[model samples]
Target: MSGTGDTAPGADAGELPAYAERVLSVAELIPAGRVMTYGDVAEYLAEEGQPEGLPAEGGGGRRVGGPRQVGRVMALYGGAVPWWRVVRADGRLLPGSELRALAHYRDEGTPLRAASQGSDDHIPKIDMRRARWDGRQDERDAPWDD
Candidate 1:
């Protein structure tokens, strides 16, 4: 779908792919001081059009995408949003942008764990347990349950 229309949050409708628009919208929903893994964002979007308790693959809606697509969207169009909040599942800071992401994390009070003494980069890792956000304001309103 190509059109010169406005979409959600950070992009013009035709400027980005439909899936990319949805991906960025989810990224924007992430609360400050919290984060979601790439897979989390993808899974969230995939489930958005699916029926309750149904697997994404079984849903009749168009396939949104997966972790790699999310990463690609972020890498290409994430500069204008809180790109740092979408992270690796293992909690390591994004490579190459580690210092930049760390600054934002510190500013937002995102939970972080000290890197082990022998860690390669010496940058602190995000404390995934404490910092991961489920993108739900309340359990009852959640689109899907674990």
Candidate 2:
């Protein structure tokens, strides 16, 4: 595993750990105007690999890594996917890439909440209540059944 070269998108196969690849695959599946938390992405992959009827949060008996691991994968290989579509559980934009991500969110019409009253800037934050994607369904229920 140590010797594997870059496995990010556009790179050759086998460069990424199997789990990392699966993580990225799920990242790619997230649609525009929608977002999944790192934990959500992990759970989504877990559910997809496991049989139906598993617990929604843990994916019964499966071992999907936590949000930190999912974030690591995103840090290393998420450039090719809709990285912005994967966000924190709190719905705050990625720390350093907030503006860039905000652009995408705006372009995609992702739901957002105005900055808090005491905040210095007017930068809007994602409205997780409205924008979170569970990888199960969108508002239209067009994709991802189960």
How many clashes (backbone N, Cα, C below 3 Å) per candidate?
A: 0, 0
Residues 1-146 of candidate 1 have per-residue lDDT tens digits of 11112222444434767677677677777888889999988777765463343333334335668899888888777876788889999999887778888999999999999999998778999988888888775533432224
Quote model 1's TM-score. Answer: 0.76
Best by lDDT: 1
lDDT of 1 at 91: 94
Give the residue spans of candidate 2 off by over 4 A: 1-14, 48-61, 137-139, 142-146
**How does each model score on lDDT?**
0.74, 0.72
Estimated TM-score for each candidate: 0.76, 0.76
lDDT score for candidate 1 against the true structure: 0.74
lDDT of 2 by residue, 12-36 (tens): 5547676676777777777799888
